[model samples]
Target: MHAGPRPSILFVTDLAYPARGRRYCDEDIFLTSRLREEFDVALCHPRDAAALLDGFDAVVVRNSGPVLHYQEAYDAFCARARERKVPVYNPLTGRGDMAGKQYLVDLSAAKYPVIATVDRAGDLGLLPGAAEYVIKPKLGADSVGLRFVTPDALAAEVGAEPDGSVLVQPRIDFRYEVSFFFIDRDFQYALYAPHPEQRWVLEPYEPTTADLAFARRFVEWNDLAHGIQRVDACRTADGDLLLVELEDLNPYLSLDRVTDEVREAFVARMKTSVRALLH
Candidate 1:
């Protein structure tokens, strides 16, 4: 190995943002601690990233909370990074939730195994019928502005939504929600919420080949050359997985719930991935 000063990384995060179930600060703290072994790392709030990221070899945006919280600042950071050609860990080319929820509607229309979505209120008939439907802002994240409406009220509620501002889908009665975590194109570990009612109580998941295939389909579809991605899906009563969301930017890694062996492996893979980016 060539000897040189370790690469400096500007780690972007919002440590104080109160996430409902996950500890954004704890995950980022642990990750940075591990990363520090291989690189010179520093933390900065999302709003500060544009100004602070200039001198770093790369920037890793982790648990930075929803960009909507600081849309203008986040946009500026992305623009500046592009102009300066500074490497972003999860490169700015992500087209999944990193962009917005519009991908759900596109994926659904493409006949993918995704929650059926329609952007216009008049298109509710396009989706499979259900007792209730989900209405949420297209730019929303972390369950922000998410709500359920019965079919009777869905039309009116959606009709009230500004054009192209929200998406509507049937409220899936799912078995469990699971997530497949990845670094670049590599699969890391998986986690799932056993109780639908408690979204935060996650357990280690051992994915089957079929499950991996399903998750991989979306990851491959996203086609990012670098960066972390979390493919979130809901297993239905019929045991089929439907895409819930694809979180490519700042997907939380539940490091504590994973075995120490797994956690270390992830860190190692991440270091390899980041190193690959720097190279």
Candidate 2:
């Protein structure tokens, strides 16, 4: 395309996004540093991607923070990328939380094992009964504006027609949470936080056959071709996993938590995947 050997990439990230319980910048810094070995890489903020993308062979969107903060700019980038046919990592067809939490409602309607979810006032009964339920922006990220409310308060809040701005889910009383990481449909590793309150304190997890099966179902469901994915799940008191969220768009790899060998292998695999996208 550009008559050069190296495949140039515009790595989009927001190094300043104040992500609670996570350092988004640190992860991207580590990744882009490793990626320089195989490509002509440049980093930019999400708001600046559309302007510079035409010069790069591909745009690797990672740790760019929620698109809601810069919807107009992000929309322009997506529009231009598609019009010019610039390859986007994750391929933009992800049907999970990447697109929005709407897929959760869709999956729940189709009877998937995801936590019961609904966005409208009329659909509240579909969710399981609990002493309290969680309400959040349907298009939210990083647990922003999330609240737990009693059923009575929830009913009143739902009745207010609050701009159709939120989603509701039963407060799942799970024992712990686990995440299954994938690279283009291939399982890479699993990690868990033994304590629910300590979400970032992760340890390598060995999943059972059934657990892997459960996680794979969501990965297959999202159907992304080339990108990282993390299947976030919560274990019920009965020791079964329920799908919590499918993070396809810019899913943090948590690379620091893994063994060096695994991390290197992942970086190598990503380089190969990104290189294949040059075609």
> Which predicted model would earn the best lDDT?
1
Per-residue lDDT tens digits for candidate 1, residues 1-279, read: 224588899999988989997788999999999999999999999999999887888999999999999999999999999998999989999999989989999999899999999999777789998988999999999888999989899888988875879999999999999999999889999999999999879999999999999999999999999889999999998999999999998998888889999999999999999999988
What's the lDDT for all of these models? 0.92, 0.88
Tell how far residue 194 is off in model 1, in angstroms.
1.0
TM-score of each: 0.97, 0.96
* Model 1 alpha-carbon drift over 4 Å, by segment: 1-4
How do the residues 1-279 of candidate 2 rate in per-residue lDDT, one tens digit apiece? 455888888999999999777788998999999999888889999999999999988999999998888989988998999999999997878888767888888888999888898888889988888999999887898887799999989888776755667888999999999999988778888999999999888899999999999999998888777888999999999887889999988887788899998898889888988877766
- Superposed by TM-score, candidate 1 places the C-alpha of residue 80 at a distance from the truth, in angstroms, of 0.3
> Which pairs clash (backbone N, Cα, C closer than 3 Å) in model 1?
none
Model 2 alpha-carbon miss at residue 116, Å: 0.8
